[model samples]
Target: MTRSNTARRTVAALLTAGVSAVLMTAAPAHADSNDSCHPSGAMPRVGVFGNEFAPAPSDPLVRAQGWVDAGLTCSPMGSFGGYRTDAGGYAAMAWRLTESMEPSELLSTGSVTPLAGRDDLAPGDGLLNPAGFGHAVVFDHWADDAHTSYLGYEFTAAGVQHRTIPYPYFAGQGDFRPVRAAR
Candidate 1:
């Protein structure tokens, strides 16, 4: 083949490979089972009308801050992106925003990764209480230098809360586990 023709073919092949790679990595991870009653069209479309859920970035602080900046509140209308109340609602927000996966799906699919311990927790990591009732908190920062206490945002009947939480209280019985977004 002519040099020009060969070069053209090489460029086309590289471009094709690049596009394929982008599509593969850009697509959100999916699970065969999703029990959570996620709102229709909620996965991709965020912050419409009443919904305040948005995907968190890789940075731990950025993830938590997204909720604060969006003024997210725990509400029953979580699927619709309305105010989301309680830890489950917060889970819905975090799971949806971070992995584009539902919270229940994370549990069932074994996609959630366990952190070594509370000390391994990061600002944007999650403190998931999957015991009696599922709850999730977006870790913001350590309240003390020791990391024994932390400040985070959670949804509640009263509305969104940013409070200092003692590690022992939340991590009791190992129910509140530190987790990272399923990659």
Candidate 2:
């Protein structure tokens, strides 16, 4: 083959390889699992309040089940206030309520109770609850409106729990919008 034709084929092959690499590394936003919930490294601990309660020590099996369901790892460590750490050694907490987690079951825990109205939740309205699957989650809804709302979750690292609340935004109106849904 001519040198020019050979070079052109080489370039085409390189481009195809590059595209494949990108696709392989790009994971979906809501793949579900501990990998999706907690990135590499360590998770952090957090605190909880109100009627919220942490998973009991004897309930490791229950907590593990919850974590698996939510795509997370449950490791019980200790308790502070009302929050408790899971076997994965991260401080976690959860609240119990019966509600619909339609659209995206991956993000929704089927226990989030909608506040009376937008006025019910303020910018720093923090909520502590057990997210099934032995995962304890803390969220603060910083914004709420007719269209949507925004909140943040507290993650753990090493043995410390840090609060990482995302900026205010919207929630799913009809179907499950996991991107917009709060913890």
Q: What is the C-alpha local distance difference test score of each model?
A: 0.54, 0.35
lDDT string, candidate 2, 1-183, tens digits: 999999999999999999998974464332222322343444343442332344544332343334334533223333333333342222223232112111122234433444444345543223332233323333344444452534433333222232333222112211221221234
Clash count, candidate 1: 8
Off by over 4 Å in 2: 1-77, 81-83, 86-112, 115-120, 123-137, 140-160, 167-183
Compared with the true structure, what per-residue lDDT tens digits does model 1 show for residues 85-145? 4345455455544333334345655656778888887766777655433456677778998
* TM per candidate: 0.54, 0.26
- The candidate maximizing TM-score is 1
